[model samples]
Target chain A: MEKIPILRMGDFLLVTIQVDMHDRLAMALQDDLTQKISETSARGVLIDISSLEIVDSFIGRMLGNIAAMSRVLDAQTVVVGMRPAVAITLVELGMSLPGVRTALNVDAGMELLRESLNGHEGIRHGSNF
Target chain B: MAVISSETIPVTSEPDIVFVRRRVRETAAQIGLSLVDQTKVVTAASELARNTLIYGGGGAMQLESLNGPRLGVRLTFSDNGPGIPDIQLALRDGFTTGSGLGLGLGGTKRLVNEFAIESKVGQGTKIIITRWK
Candidate 1:
C-alpha cells in the first residue's frame, strides 16, 4: 500500500504532495493528517501542492475536509504552491475550496500558519462555511 | 473528425483515475494545447474517471487525438454501473448521490470545449468531452 508521508515540524505538520495522488491517497492523507495533529498537538498544517498538476472537485473537497477537520482539532491549515493553471481550472470547475486557507509558497504558507498560531485568531482566512 | 491516435485505459480502480489524468495531459500537450487547456482537459478527465469508478461501478477511458479541421483531444468515460436516473438534476452543482462535492458532472462540463453525456438506468453511462487546441 502506498502512502503519503506526514512530517512533524516544531509546531506544525507539513505535507508536500509531490505526486499526482489517486483518490484513495488523498483520502488517506486527510485521515492521517487529522490523526497526526491530534497526536502531535500541532498548531498548524501546511500542504504544498506545487507539484500537483490538477485539483478536481474531489481533491478540492478533500482539502476542504482537511481544513475543517484540522480546525476542529485546534490547528490551522494552509495549502500553498498551487499552479496558476490549476487555480484557473479549479475556479472554472466551480470549486473554491471553501474553508481552506492558501498561500503562494511554502515560506509564505509557513508564515501564515505561524500567524494563526501566534494568538492572532483574527487573521484566519478562508471559508465562511 | 479523424483520430490520429487512440488508446483505451481501464478505469476499474482509484489509481486508474490518476493514469487517466496523466494520459489526458500527455495527449493534450502532444496536440499542442496550451498549458491552460491541458490542465482543463486533464482536470475534467479526473472528475469523470472518478465518476466511472464510484458511480458507474468501473469502466474505461478512451482517448482520441483528433485532426479534423483542428487539432484536439477527446476523452470518453464509459461504465456499466447503475446509470444516472436524472441527468439534468445530476448536472446541477451541489447535487450528488454519493459522498462527493457534487461537482463531478457539472464542473467537468465547464472545463472542456465540448461536452456530451448519455446514461441509461440499470444499463450504463458514457461521457465524452473534447478540447480543441
Candidate 2:
C-alpha cells in the first residue's frame, strides 16, 4: 500500500529512498521507474539512498535492474548518497552494480545525469551532421 | 559463553525479510558492534532471510546476544522445506537454482565471523552465523 514518490526534475526522475524498503516495494519501484521513463520520455534517473542503512543482495539487484532497464528505455540512471558501510557491504556481497553510476550526493548525481544526457544529445547531433 | 537474550521471528514473506534485517541491526548495535560490523551482520541477515523465504519455503530466524570474552550477536535460520540437494554447489557464488544472482549464501558467509550450515534431502536446512564485537 505504501509507495515511493517519484519526482520529475526537468528531463530526469528523482527518487529519494528514505524508508527501509521491503522486497515488494523494491520490485514495484523498478517497474514504476521504467514506466515513468517511458511515459515522461525522461532522459535520466537519480536515486538517492543516503537514508538507507542496509542494502542486501536483493535490493542491490533491483538497483542494477533499474539501471539496465533505464538504459534500454533511453535513460541513464545515477544512484547517489550511498553510505560507506552500505557500499562496503554491497561489494562484499559481490554486487558491483556495474551498469549503475554512483555519486556522493544528490547535487553530484544531478550533475552526472546532466552530463550523461548532454553527452548522448551531442552524439545524436554528431550522427546527424 | 551464555546468551544474554534471544528471540525468534518468522520469515514467511517479503516484508518479514526487512523486519529480520532491522532486528539484526538493532541486536548487533546493542552488542556494541562497530558501524561497519553492524552493517555487515544486518546485510548478511537480509540475504539469509530471503533465502529462507524463497528457496526454503519460509522459516524462522532466532536472534541471540552472546556474552563471554567477546560480546556478539548470533542468528540461526531454520527451515523445513525441500532441502538443498547440494550444499557445496549452493554455497558457490553464481550457482543459484532459482532466478537469483546466486550471491546470498556465499556472500553472507563472508560477512560474518562464523558460519555453519547443515541440510539433508528431506530434512530441510539450518544456518547459524555469528559476528563478534
Candidate 3:
C-alpha cells in the first residue's frame, strides 16, 4: 500500500498525499494535515498531490477546508501540481478554493507561500466551516 | 432514444470498487476526454458508488450523452432508508457518522462537472452529477 508522505520544513509543513484522484484517503489526509497546521501554528502549508490520478468533489471540499482552516490558524495553504483531470473535476464539482493559493509545482507553491508570509498585511483569519 | 444510453449496477452488501471504476472510465472515455480526465471521472464515480453501498445501502448509476461536444454522466444513488438530516455536516471532512473514511459525499461532489442533491429525512438521497468531456 502506498503511504502518504509528510515533511516539516521549519515552521512550514509539506505533505505528499498519493491519491487515485478518487479515493477518500485524499480528502482524509488533507483534513488530518489541516488540523496539524492549526495545532502547530505553522506559517505555511504545502500539499503536493502530484501522484493523484483523479480529483473528485470530496477531495476538493477537503482541500478547500484545509485552506480555510489554515487561514483560521493564521497560516497560508498552497495546493500544488494538480493534474488537468483534477482541475476539470474541481470545475465540474462547482468547488472553488477561493482564498487558497495554487501552483504548478512545489517550487512555485513554496515561492507563493514565502511571498504571502513576507508581504505586509498578509495575515487574515476567516472560515466557512 | 438514440442519444440516451443507460446502464444500471445492482448494489450488494459489498460493491465492487474496481468494476464501478471501470464502468465510469469507459463512459468517460466515450466523451472524448483525455486519459487523465477519464481517470478523474472514474475516481469520482468510485467515491459515489462506495457511498451508495455504504451509506445509501444501495443505488444505481446512469450515464447520459449531453448536448455539444462534451459528454456527461449522471449517477443517481437511492436507498429506501434513513436520509441525511444535516447535509452540511455530512459534507464536512471527518464528520462521518459511520465507519470508513468520512470523505464520501464531500469528495464525490468535487469529482464531477455538476452536482445536485435531493434527500428527505427518513427517505433517501438522489445525487445527480454530470461531467463534460
Q: If scored against the real structure, what TM-score would every candidate get?
A: 0.94, 0.96, 0.60
For all predictions in the order shown, the interface RMSD in Å is 1.2, 1.3, 5.4
The sequence of per-residue lDDT tens digits that candidate 3 reaches over residues A1-129 is 444666788778998876453344555576667777767667889988887766554566677778888887778889999888667666554555566689999999999888877773423443211
- Ranking of candidates on TM-score, top first: 2, 1, 3
Give the winner by TM-score: 1 or 3: 1
How does residue B117 of candidate 1 score in lDDT?
92
lDDT of every model, 2 decimals = 0.89, 0.89, 0.69
List, for all models, the DockQ compared with the true complex: 0.73, 0.75, 0.17
The residue-by-residue lDDT of candidate 3 on B33-118, one tens digit each, is 67766775676776667677777777666655565544566666566557789888877654577574445466666656788888
lDDT of 3 at B76: 62
Which pairs, if any, clash in model 2? none
All candidates in order of DockQ, best leading? 2, 1, 3
Which parts of model 2 have CA positions greater than 4 angstroms off? A122-129
Q: What are the chain A TM-scores of the candidates, in order?
A: 0.91, 0.93, 0.78
| Residue A65 lDDT (model 2) | 95
Instruction: Compare candidates 1 and 3 on DockQ and give the better one.
Output: 1
Fraction of native contacts (fnat) of each candidate: 0.93, 0.79, 0.33
Residue lDDT tens for model 2, B1-133? 9999999999999889889988988888888999999999999998889889988889999999999979999999999988988888888876687576457478889899999999988878999999999
Worst 10 residues of 2 chain B by lDDT: B95-104
